[model samples]
Target: MDSKLNRSVIDISICSRSISDQNSSETGKESHEKKFLDKNFTTKRHLKSRHIQLIAIGGSIGTGLFVTIATGLIKGGAAGLLIATVFWTCVMLLLTSAVGEMVVQYPAPSPFVEMAGRCIDEAVECAAGWNFFLMEALYIPFEITAVSSIIDFWRDDYSAAIPISIIIALYTAINVFNVKYFGESEFWLSIGKLILCVGLLFFTLITMCGGNPAHDAFGFRYFKIDPFGSGYVTTGGLGKFEGWLGALFQANFFVVGPEYISMIANEAHYPVRKNLSTCFKTVIWRLCLFYIGGALSVGILIAYNNPTLVAANTAGESSAAASPYVIAMENLNIKVLPDIVNAIILLSALSAGNSYFFCSSRQLYSLSKRGFAPAFFQICTSSGVPIFCILVVIAFACLSFMELGTGGSLTALTYITSICTKSQMLNYLYMGVTYIAFYHACKAQGIDKSTYAYRSWFQPYSAYIVTFFLLVLCGVQGYTVFLPGWWSVEDFIFYYIMIFVNVAIYIFWKVIKRTPFRKSSEVDLVSGLKEIEEYEYEHFKIAEEAQINSDTDSEDYKKKNAKEIFNNVKTWIF
Candidate 1:
C-alpha cells in the first residue's frame, strides 16, 4: 500500500510538471492575473467538506418544499403532484451530475458564468452572470416575504416591516463578517431544517397510521378518492393539463438551484475530486428524501379538496395558514405541532434568505472580477468578505417592505417570484448547455474524459438531454396564461419577462461584441487547469514528505494511522 501510494504521488508530480512546462513553453510567460492560486485576492478557502454538503442540502430544500408544495397539491391533486415532483427530481439529479463534472475540474466562484466565457462565449458569460445575480436578488425578497408570512402564525398585530428589518439585518451581518461565519451559520441552519424534515416525515407516517387524535388513518385515502384535481382556470382536459404544468413548475422551484452548491464549492477548503464527488453523491438522496419524499408525504397528509386548502389558495396568503402541513395538523386536532412547524418554517425561510444574500453577493463579485461589473464590486474586506457586493444585495432586501402597504407586498412578491422562477430556469438551462460545451472542448483538446478526476455518467448525452428539456420547460412554463379568456397581462409579463430579459441581454451583447460560439479546439482550459494542478501537486509533495518523516519516527508512527498523520500534516499546510 505504501509503495503504491508513493507511486501515485510521483505520477501526479510528473503530470503537474509536464503541464507547467507545456504552458510555459507556449505562453513564454505565465499569466499571474489568470491564476487563482493566491489567497489574498481570491475568496478564502474556509468552507469545509461538511460546509459544502449542508449548503447543497440547505439550498435545495427551501420554503418551496414546506409552503409552496401546497400550491401544487391544490392544482394537480396528490397523484399528479407526486409524479411531477418525482420526475423533476430525476431531472435535477441529471443536471447536478453534469455540473459536478465541470465544477470538480475547474472550481471557481460563479463557475457556470466563468465556464461560459471559457468554453462558450463571453456574451453568454455576461448574460448568465447578470441573470443569476438578478434572480438571487429577487429571491431575497421572496424569502423575506415568507418570513413575514410565517410570523403571521404567531402574531397578526405587528407590521411586516419589523420582522423583515430584523431578518435582513441579521443575515447581512453574517455575510459581512467572513466567509466561514456564513458557512458555519448555514451549516447549523441546514441541520435544523434537516431535523425538521425528518421529524415531519416520521410524524407523517404516524398520522397515516391513525396515531392522531382523530384516529382516522388516511392511508392513501386522498389518492384513492381523487387522484386528479378539478382544473385550474378551465374545467376539462385542458384545465387538468394546465394544472399538471403548474405542479411541474412548482417542483422546478423546489429543486431549481442546486447549482448553488457548486458555486459555494469554489470557497471550499478542498475544492477537488473528493469534496465535489461526495457533494454530488448526496444529491440523489436529497432529491429522494427532501423533495420527492416530502411531496408524497404532503399528499398523504392533506387531501386536495380539503376546505382549508381551498381557502388558503383563494386568499393567496403566504402565512402558515396556507401550508398544508399546518392544515393537516389542524384537522387532526394536533394543536402544538402546528405552531412548532410554523416556527421551523420561519427558520427555513431565514436560512434561505441567508443563502440568497451569499449567492447574489458572490455573483456580483465574480462579475466584477471578470470586468463585466464595476471594479469596486471586486473589493473584499481583509477577512474575505465582499462588503460592497453584500451591501448591494442587502439593499434589494428592502423590497420586502413593500408588503406593509395595501396589497403592495403580495403584488411585488407575485411578480418577483415569477421572474425569479424564470431566471432560475434560465440558470439551469445555461448550466446544461455549458456542460455540453465543456465535454466537447475536452474531447477536441485530446483530453480523455474517462481519466478525468470526476467523470459524469452519461457525459455529452446527458447534457444534451437536460439542455433540451430545460429549453422546453422555460418556454412552456407560462402556458396557462395563454388559455382562452384567461389572459391577464400582469400574469403574462411576470411569467415571461425573465425569458425576454435573458435573450435580450444575450443578443444585445452578441451584436455589440460580435462574440461568436467558441470553437472546441480553441477553448482555454490550460490556464485554469495549470493552476489547479500546481496546487494539488504541492499538497501531494507535502503529504509525501510528511509520511516519510513520520515513518522514521517508529514510535509516533505506530501510535497513529498513516491516513490520520497525513491529514494532520495537510491541515497544517493548508
Candidate 2:
C-alpha cells in the first residue's frame, strides 16, 4: 500500500555504448501505459499534495514513536535513543534527496520500481518490487497487532481477534470500494496525527519544566543519571555499542523516508510538481522536529530505570502507562492528559493501520502492473481499486491473530519491528543504488541534472554517503543474535531474513531471466516523459478551475486571499 531494481549487482563499470537509439525504442509501450495508467488496470490519481504528504508523515509517526519509544528508552537509555533518532533523521534527509530527484523525473506507478528497471536492470526491478511488496504487506498486521496492544492501555486482556476482524473488514471496504475514500480518510487522519504530535511535544516540554501539578522540573534529569544503557547480553564498550545499535534499529522503525511520498506521487496529481518538491523538502524537517525532538523530550521527562517502565518491559506490555511519556505524566499526578494522549495514540494507530493497509495494496498492485506479480492483481475496478491486490493483502492480515499467542502484542511488535525496519532501510539502500545508476546515466547520456523536474542537494555525493552507512547498518542490526546467550532463531530470522531474501530474489532474477545490465547511455529516460508532463499540466488546470469556482463566492477577493494564506500557514506549522 505504501512504498525495485533493474540494475546488475556487479559489473559496476560504465558502458561505453551509445543509447541514442534508446528514444526510438522508448516509444514507451511494453504496454506499461496499458498496464499502469489504464484506470481499468491501476488506481486513479486522487491524492492531493496534502493527502500524499500527510499519509507519509502519519505513517511514519505511529506506534513506533508513540507506543514503542519506551523500548528504545529501556534498551538504549536516553543518550542512545536520542543519538539514534538524530542519526536516522540525517539518513532520511539524504535518502529523501536521492529518491526525490528520481520521482521528479519519473512519476510512474511505484515510481522507484519502474525507474530501477529503466536505469539499472529488470532483475533489480523484480527483486526491489517484491522486497517493497513484502515490506508494506507485512506492516499491515504489525500495525493491527499494535492497535490491539494499545488497547491493553485500558483492558488488561481481550481477544485480539475481535479488533483484527473488524479492521480487516474496514480495510477491504475502504480499499476495494473507492480510492477517494482512501485519500480523504488518510487526509483527515493525518490531520489528527499532526495535532497529536504538536500536543505531545508541548506536553513533554511543559511537564519536563515543572509545569505539571507536582512542579518537579525534571529537565535532563535522566540524561544526567543514565546517559547510556548497559545493553543486552553484553557489557563494557561492546555493550554500549550494542545499546546504540539497538537504538538505531528501533529508531529506524519511526523515521520512514521520502519513499512513502514516492509511493503516492503518481496519485498526488496535486497540480504542482513544485509542491511535491516542497513535500519532499519539508518531510525531513517534520521528522527531525517531531521524532528527534520527541526522543530528546522523553529523555528530559523521565529516567530510564523508572519502576513503571521496568515492570511493563518485563511483562512485555505495550500499554499507555508503559510509555515513558505517560509514566512521566502519571508521576506528576497529571492523570487526565495521559488518557487523552493514549486515546489520540490509539487513533494514531488506526490512522497508521489504514495508511499501511492502503499502501501495501497499492504496492502489490504496482508489482502486478510491472509483471513481477500475477496478472489478476493488475485488474482494477471502474473506481480504480485493485480488488485482487487488496484481497491478497487482506488474506495476509490474518497474521494479526498471532498476537494472541505467547508474549502477545509486545512480542509480535518486537519481531515485526526488526523485519519491517530493516526491510524499509533495505528499500532505502535500493534507492541509493538506483539513484547512483540514474545519476551516472544522466551524465553519460548528456542529460543535465539541473534540467530535472526537481534538484536535490549534494546529489551523487549524498547517494554515496548514504549507501555506505545504510549497508553498514543493514548488516550490523542482527549482531545481537550472534552473541552468547542471546541467540534467538525467531529474532534472527525476523532481523536478517529480509536481507537474505532480498539478495536471493536479486540473484534469482539475474540468473533465471539472464537479464543484462543496461548501459548508462541506454537508460530509458525519455519513456513516459511526455505523458507525465501532460498529466501535470492537466491536473493543474483542473485544480485551478476548481479554485476559481470556489473563490467566486468570496465578497472581497483580497481579504479571502489573506484568510486562505493565514489558514495554510497555520496548518503548515501547527
TM-score for each model: 0.88, 0.87
Q: Which stretches of candidate 2 lie over 4 Å from their true place?
A: 1-41, 156-158, 270-272, 405-418, 539-571
Please give the range of 10 consecutive residues that has the lowest summed lDDT in model 1.
32-41
Clash count list over all predictions? 1, 16
lDDT at 402, model 1: 78
Residues 1-574 of candidate 1 have per-residue lDDT tens digits of 9858866776787777879978876775456435432324557778877778777777777888888788898888898899998888778888888888888878878887899998999999989999999998989988998888888878889877888899899988899887999988988888778878888999999999999998988788888746768887677987787787788888988866457777786687754657777777765566577787788998998888898888887887677788888898898889898888888888888888888889999999999988788988887776777778888998899888877777765676678766888888889999988888888898899987676667787767878888899999988888768877879889899889887888888898899889888999999887666556556666677778988777665876766777667755533221
lDDT of each: 0.81, 0.78
| Per-residue lDDT of model 2, residues 1-574, tens digit only | 1100212211121121124335534776465444532434556778766666777787777867875787788778899999988988888888888888888777777888888898899998998888888888888887787777777777856687888898888877777777778877777777887887888888888877778887788777789875878664577877777777778788887777876788777776655466578788777688788898888887788787888888987776666767777887778788688878888787788888887777788888888778788888888876788887888888778778777777566476557645877788788888889999999999999987776667987878989999899988888877878877879889789888888998899898898889989999999899877566656655565677877777565777668778878867754863
Q: Compute the lDDT for candidate 2.
A: 0.78
